[model samples]
Structures are given as structure tokens and as C-alpha cells.
Target: MADARSTAAYLCGKLYATLWALGVLGTAAPTPSPLTPGRDESTARFPRDELKRRLAAAGAHMITAKGRGGDRAQAASEVFRSIPDLIPVAGLPQKRYTNQEVLQFSQGCAAQLTTYREKYGSLLH
Candidate 1:
């Protein structure tokens, strides 16, 4: 049946999304490997002001930049950037990574988030 097929597809997608969030599909090896094993790239090698300058070079501003308003993907990236490494999630520290690395991890988080929104949002809303 059409309804049955839709339901099954949805369930499979949901399960896949959850597994991906759990990092079953991530690049790094399974847990116990330090998520960020190195020193802070900016602080360790560059001065704080220079680090800010590099982030600005990367198009990040203390004030939100243009063309990003209402763009969920961009907004998700900003949220991800704001996360500190001190915060731990799923047995990983959120810090000590390069901006690029953090952003990559954020893409996975955002995908999982989007999937969750698709799955349970209508019910909760």
C-alpha cells in the first residue's frame, strides 16, 4: 500500500538518522578517541587578535553577516560555531578543534537535527 510504503520509508530514514547522530556514520573511529586531540590552533600558534582576524577572514563577524537571515543551514552553522569545546556530547568534547573541523562535525549535527524536525516536529507542535 502507498501508506505502508511511506511509513516504512519514514521509519528507515529515522533510524538511519539516529544512527548517524550516534556517530555510527562519522569519519572518526568509534568512541574513546579524543575528538579534539590537539591544542587550540588559534591560541596555540596565533595571538587572540590574530585568531579573531582569521575568523573574520573566514567571513565570520561579531555581528551577524548579511544574506544569512532565515537561512536555516547558515543559522545552523552559526549555532555550531558558538558551541564551546568544554561542552561534551556523546562522549566527545566540543572544543580544541579547528574551525573547519568543527564546521564539518556541525554538518552532521545539523543533518540529524533536520531529520528530527522532520520526524517529531508535527507531533510536538
Candidate 2:
């Protein structure tokens, strides 16, 4: 909930989890493990080029949707908000992540996310 504590990787992990649960990332069925864990490249590291495109697109949709209807906590407003609330999501071109950002997403992907899933999985579904 606090900006100080959350990171992009954590947020991206949440995004990836939701996509997986809704059957968006890989199969039409929501299965166990993102991109089949050890099999797919995205399972370990999200495709950098594609992630930016999808994230920007998703962020644009969020802005539009939020403008039309107000937000509830379930929407993970903080993800968009953590877009720093300054940098326009649509203009994310030329963006580069620091080491910290890379590390956080890695943690979100592989480890340290069990508690997050346990705590927030219901809201997501």
C-alpha cells in the first residue's frame, strides 16, 4: 500500500499473476506456474521489448478506464501510481531500469512472492 515499500518487479509480478490467473499469459486455462516455470523464457525474465509495449498499452487502458469510472483498490491503482505518478505512461519510450528495478522483478518472478499471492490472490480473482 505504501509507495516506499513497493517496487516495479513486485507490481509486475502481480500483473503477471493476474494475467496468468485470467489465462492471458500462456494457455487459455489458468494453470500453475507462469509460462510453465522452467520451460519458457518469460518464466524467468519477461521479454524486455514486449513487456514495455504491453505495459504501456495496459497503462494507457488504465488511464482511459479510470477516467471513465473511478477506481477501487482491487484494480491495483498503485501499479499505475507507481509509474511514479509523474512519468506519463504513454511516453515510456527510452525508459531504462536501474539495477534495483531488475532485482525486484526477478524476486517477484521467482521468489519472495508466496506471501503476496496468499494475501492478494483473492482480490485479484
Candidate 3:
């Protein structure tokens, strides 16, 4: 099941790029959309130290949290790991990015993903 979700997320990322290329979805214009808080952030470049700080601020612990239906921590980790795949759209020349930029880019990607899900709900399922 985790494998399936991972594959789905990978496919979703690819589909987003395809849609953007086809102009179905907008380009990575770097504009502040409702999903992304643009102006509030300094730049779209989150460093490791900052990332650790942000995670710490969020009270993220190392313990794995599991539930009856599924392991959400694992799922979230999987998603977090997949974030690097979005660097192109985020306009990050390097792997490193700002937390706000990362968040904004993530929000934009998620928004595009939501649109994709709505458009191809049956196909994906």
C-alpha cells in the first residue's frame, strides 16, 4: 500500500509537469497564489539549519506515530521525501531552498495536484 501511494505521488508529480507544459496548469510563475504565502517570505531558499529549526518549531518529534487505519507518519515522510522532485517548479537552482519558498512551492504544487485530482478523479482511482 505504501508502495502504491508512493507510485501515485510520483505519477502525480509527473502529471503536474505535463499539465504545466501543456498549459493546462499555469507555469511556475513564482506568483503568490492563495495556496502560497509569497510576500511574507524572504526568499525561496530553505537551508538545512532553517529546516531543522522550522521542524523543531513545529514540535516534530522522532517518534513514529501509528494509527488503526494507516501510519500517517510514514505517509507524511514519504511525501516530504518527494518534495525534492518539485525543485524545478519552485525555481530553486540548488537543492537548498528557504522554508517559506519551500512552503509556497509546496502549496502551489498541492493546488495543482488538487486540480488534477478533481479533473481525473475516476482515472486515478
Candidate 4:
């Protein structure tokens, strides 16, 4: 389960932690989980417009949040470029994934993560 919104949010988080590790950023309060009874956003596939809004929000968080005065905009741009552009109403296909499958997908995504200093964290990319 990894829709555009959730996947973009996950990428934002991965980039944030990378920045933190590079000692160029500060942390803010934790974001509320998109999980709860009767609802799990990770599996939710939103429309194209909504996806764009969510992407904008993620980008704003990266660029506008307190981050040791580093140029986070470039980092955000680089991280987001890993995913397909969210456009077209006939958007991505949805899949209801098992917990383990989701975990594997997330690990795969992390392995392909990009940082400011490298095109990708894993050389296999």
C-alpha cells in the first residue's frame, strides 16, 4: 500500500532524516500518523488534484520548517524527483497490500533514496 500522497510523505520523512544525519537540519514535532481504526491512509489512492496538494504540503514542510538554515528546497526537489509526477485523472492503480508486502515496498523505496550529496543511497541504483 503506497499511494502518491503516502509515498510522497514517506520520501519527505526519509529526506528529513538524511538531513538530520548530515547535521544540517533541526527537527520539529512528529507528524500525526495517518493510521487509525477503520482507516489506513497508506493504502488510500487519492485523485490527481488531491495528490498534487499533498505533494505541495510535503514540499512546504521540507522547505519552510526549521532546518538549521540549510537550503532544504533542493533536497526536497531531489527526493521528490524519485517518484512519478502526479498528474492525470486516470491516476495510479491501487493495491491492498499485506503488512509484509508493505514493509518490503518501503525497504525497497529506502534503498533507492536520494540524498543531497548522492544520486542514490544504494549503489545498485
Q: Which residue pairs collide in model 3, if any?
A: 45-97, 45-98, 46-97, 46-98
Give the TM-score of each candidate. Answer: 0.26, 0.40, 0.29, 0.35
Whole-model lDDT, model 1: 0.33
C-alpha lDDT of candidate 3 relative to the true structure: 0.35
Local error of candidate 1 at 62, Å? 36
Q: Write the per-residue lDDT of candidate 2 for residues 1-125, one digit (tens) a residue.
A: 53522655555544544433323211223345654546644433543554455455655445543544433233445434433442224433234455555455555544423543565554333
Over 1-125, each residue of candidate 4 has an lDDT whose tens digit, in order, gives 55543454344333333332222212244332232235533533222233345554554455553343434444444444543442223343244445544443344334333333364232111
TM-score, predicted candidate 1 vs. hidden true structure: 0.26
After superposition, the stretches of candidate 2 with alpha carbons farther than 4 Å from their true spots are: 1-35, 42-46, 61-74, 83-106, 111-116
Model 4 error, position 51 (Å): 7.7
Candidate 2 global lDDT: 0.44
Give a tens-digit lDDT track for model 1, residues 90-122. Answer: 323224545543444434434545754564442
Per-residue lDDT, model 3, residue 118, is 63
Best by TM-score: 2
Q: What is the C-alpha lDDT of each candidate?
A: 0.33, 0.44, 0.35, 0.38
After superposition, candidate 4 runs with Cα above 4 Å error: 1-27, 30-56, 62-71, 85-93, 98-100, 113-125
With a 3 Å backbone cut-off (N, CA, C), the pairs that clash in candidate 2 are 9-105
Worst lDDT window (10 residues) for model 3? 60-69
